[model samples]
Target: MFEYQNNNYENRNQMYDYYQMPETGGPACNRPSGPKKTGKAGKLVKKIGAITLSAALFGSVAAGSFQAVNTLIGPTETSDNTAATENTSASLLKAAAIPGAASEKGSLDVSDIAETVMPSIVSITNKSVQEIQNYFSMFGYGGQTIPQETESRGSGIIIGKNDTELLIVTNNHVIENADTLSAGFIDNQVYEANVKGTDPANDLAVIAVPLESISADTMSQIAVASIGDSDSLKVGEQVVAIGNALGYGQSVTTGIVSATNRTMGSNTQVVNTSADGSALPTYIQTDAAINPGNSGGALVNMKGEVIGINSAKMASTEVEGMGYAIPMSRVSDIIETLMNETTRTKVSADQKSSIGISGLTVNESVNSIYGIPSGVYVASVTPGSGADKAGIKKGYVITGFDGKTITQIQELTELLQYYPAGETVEITVKIPATGGTYTEKTLSVTLGAAENSNNTQTESGQQEDKNNSIY
Candidate 1:
């Protein structure tokens, strides 16, 4: 068994990856299948042959055993598909740091910019079949997770289009864990979408919808939004925000850049750290009216170029005029990384095995005061997960996986890299009885699929329609 070790550091700032978790709580309603509003680029063209990108597709499974869906496939090296929009985004990000480099500065005609970019914007609707556990299932009673339907609204921007598919970018939360995804265009038309790649921790994802979904004329009408240089932005600069406000039709909000390089404390976010070791995310703070369903929308400059992605806002009785957007400079690499994705080796939710517990990373104070080890402190468990089947429950502290010592969530994730679905392994957990004493136990757990491991967390995150505001 791996043992917990004690080490100390001072003033280490924990930078949670910055992502505004969009709220989903509200009355469920059918998303309007509006008429397809054609854009300059989405107009019909010659029908191209289909392109099939398949990952680790699981074959037939035997009785009583589950396999994880395909794991993500990516290139060992970068693809050479350099389009103009991609180059423009790179140039814009550079302009911020180069003294003489800047997009034509000055106030721009908001109307002209809005019209040019609006065609790239789209409304996203997610349809899901969730399993709801009845009362008996709640307390270890005979509760089975039943299928329930839920729908949510958000927005996306058309970034690039290939011969066969139109690639769009949006927040991962909008399409995450959904059974079906659809994109509604300005013209009263909606088409099925498939996930090309997603980075949930970064709150970024790319989805592909077939070109055949729209007529050649409609395809010609759609335009690809030009990514602008966020680094070139000055505080107090004018910007425009557009989104499917309140699940209604597209609405526009105008404001100035409020601040730059801002940070906020929130629930655990999965983000990358800078080489210098900062945990904070960069943002272009603005006063734009970024409301619900705007999480993945655009924040553009006067030139009508996208410089940032509208993400979060300060919501409180006491706070106002504060909203945050991920700077385009910081996101260029992330978006490119996602676009390069080609396959998924992991299984989907239903077929995978998992330890079944959700947890929080314990900090030093808790460890020093309560003697609780610094590791993943279990908060809950999925009823049907491998950890649950092994009798694991909430409040158990997982200290080790296999033979590796783990003291943090990152370590556990790294250790998990070695194990896969349908595989059995030994895990060390600390369980305490009612009297406040602890016992260490080793359990033989057959690991569930990875996709299944994320289901409970996704379901819990989507449970309430409350907290459904921007970020």
Candidate 2:
């Protein structure tokens, strides 16, 4: 579970609840709030203040720095350039001065590591239209949803380059609901971005920028980040964080490995838990400052290799320096899935169906302890969808659907892939009882048409409408 820190924590909670509302209490939409097992694993993650830079490294700058020299004369055009050039020779010289510099060493120059990783890092700005409802408007019956354009800032790492596009990986939360995305380079160049793919379960997303939008000179200077083995990380090892700290350009923070394989709990709103009850995404805990806008930044080791992606941090009056990141090892496959371009394509009306439900696979341990079988737990049912019309109730665990053995929400998603919109399918569910007994029931459900084109499974079994027209 990711911890969000803020003073307006209660207001954020209210906003989160409001996000699940359908414009007119339509039957097709499932409210975000639903009855479920509640457990407090850690403090609630809330708002991170503005201007705070959250990175792993505490010492100085990204890549290298150039000293600006002024000639005693007033500012005027001259044959000599005032700004100095990068000193590659100094890196060599510094490396040479260090003991065993020619071979693998425990530490490398922090500035050099930042300099090397900085070009690969870019700041991202997300602009989305947030439509809020004014229930108190004219006679109360004339309430309407008001659309407001909002802007958010975060950081991303250039991971791959194709002939036509440059791809960067970042937290899904960074670009969620974004109507327009822009990527900014250290040179102050910005490029319009397109959503390549996203997996909110892990809070990961892949955004692509047109290579043609970048200048030839700047493109030549940009480098793809070198990915490292997060499994190889050891506690107490030094690491650095670089990101658009607190929405103000990219900044760096330094710290050591405070802990590893840490589990704050599962964020059911985003993270997908394992069906087998193993392998919850563990975090690399550090003491670095993880402020606002650091959500999608990189956490690199001293060797100038990115081992983790900065995700969340613990912020409170009683807490200090408890930052967290997702291990890079666990991110590779999800990123590759999002990078494939076609994974997030718009769905044709005949290609997909929506059941009007929002649910997720339950935690294995919780299910077992509660005497409930491990399966997809329905959080809420859409008012008049196939599931609701079939008398399917929330809190029921789905064991099978259309003859497919469904033990997890992911399986249910795969099963739905074989069906088309406006198709009727049989659903099998197991109802729980007070005495640890379950009754199996079969129901016929006619799936509804998914809204718009970008119809994809968001959570395990949840199909979130991408079209913002309905607010």
Candidate 3:
């Protein structure tokens, strides 16, 4: 089974191929009904016409599927009528194209699509440091941790660029905890990349590579992907997936839209409601093979327009060809926001800011048990600190920091690593309302210097320090 951050991905059954043809003739304002004939011969002629139209429409979809199969395997000879049938099918396919969506509603050549779209796709490499505790510490020896560097691979789509950076979009998990990020472009050259911004709740992130780092040759070789309307997507429509599958560089896989508007958790499991406080995200389910390294890849239509971002795949011994993607139409605005966020670097420990609050993580379980808001439950706010000065009370739950949503004290702590001392940020809190209810309030707080960073307390009243502390 393919595993991405140990999450289980899911997908459901597909839908029908073609749409029902309209019986009415032309526009309603100038509509005209065809002359009716009562004779049995006339009825027989109408039946034959209906069958011919259905055959042509069905033949269009069948031809596309056959081409997909042929693209997978070697080609085989077809009957002489195939040419004429395909010509008729093409006309019907065009007539059936969804009105609002720009469609390539005809025979598809997988190789042509791959050649056109691969330049906009890139392979991502994330290098991060993980701490591993010594096993000897369990046997009475002093506990010590070792820093280990790890590398992982994923894929990304080149969306756009700014004055100094080339912006690429990918799944947040692909670059999570990344100490150093790199993008390998179509030119076979790798360049350093920085996280522009991240929406962890949606599992989306935009990374930027400096224009100066990329060679002109590479710049000429790569292209920005053409974005398509996911809202216009129809079930069973053929789509192509391009990604750095298994970290073997970009590869192409073909499939059909199995389903849409499938609500899912950030972990990729099918869920009606998010277990976390964040909003539940929806995905486009397809039969495409989205592998481990395929996370953050492109799911494009036959026109080579990106309609979805390939994120996860359902891998099971009992099921096959089920994958999920974040629909492009749903997150277009989010991507813009991420792209506009100021690129930041982790502040040094000495220069970092502290919110000066002792808080405990309150998740869905805590909310259900205590009837409190799901966020960082502030047990104490230090006097004269930024949080306290901003009118943050002891019982208030910190729900958001700057623009990022916070469900746990650890999230707040992690975010504090980027904002330096004296930088003012907006913090959203849930204040205690009448009858144990909570009302969200946004407060502007100037972060304080980390002078007492080592003297934080956990929920159990245990003394903790930064880097090793839970809060």
Best by lDDT: 3
lDDT value for model 1? 0.66
Q: lDDT of all the models against the reference?
A: 0.66, 0.69, 0.78
| Model 3: residues with Cα > 4 Å off, grouped in runs | 1-107, 138-142, 265-278, 456-471
Q: Least accurate stretch of 10 residues (summed lDDT) in model 2?
A: 11-20
Per-model TM-score, in order, reads 0.54, 0.56, 0.72
All predictions: root-mean-square deviation over Cα? 32.8, 32.1, 16.9
- TM-score quality measure for candidate 2: 0.56
> What's model 1's TM-score?
0.54
Model 2 Cα lDDT, one tens digit per residue, 369-437: 776776777766666567778887777888777644466675566445446777787788888776778
lDDT value, residue 190 of candidate 1:
81
**Order the candidates by lDDT, highest first — what do you get?**
3, 2, 1
lDDT of 1 by residue, 136-219 (tens): 787997757878899988888888877778888888777766667888777747888877776544567888887877787667
**Between 1 and 3, whose TM-score is larger?**
3
Q: How many clashes in each structure?
A: 56, 17, 0
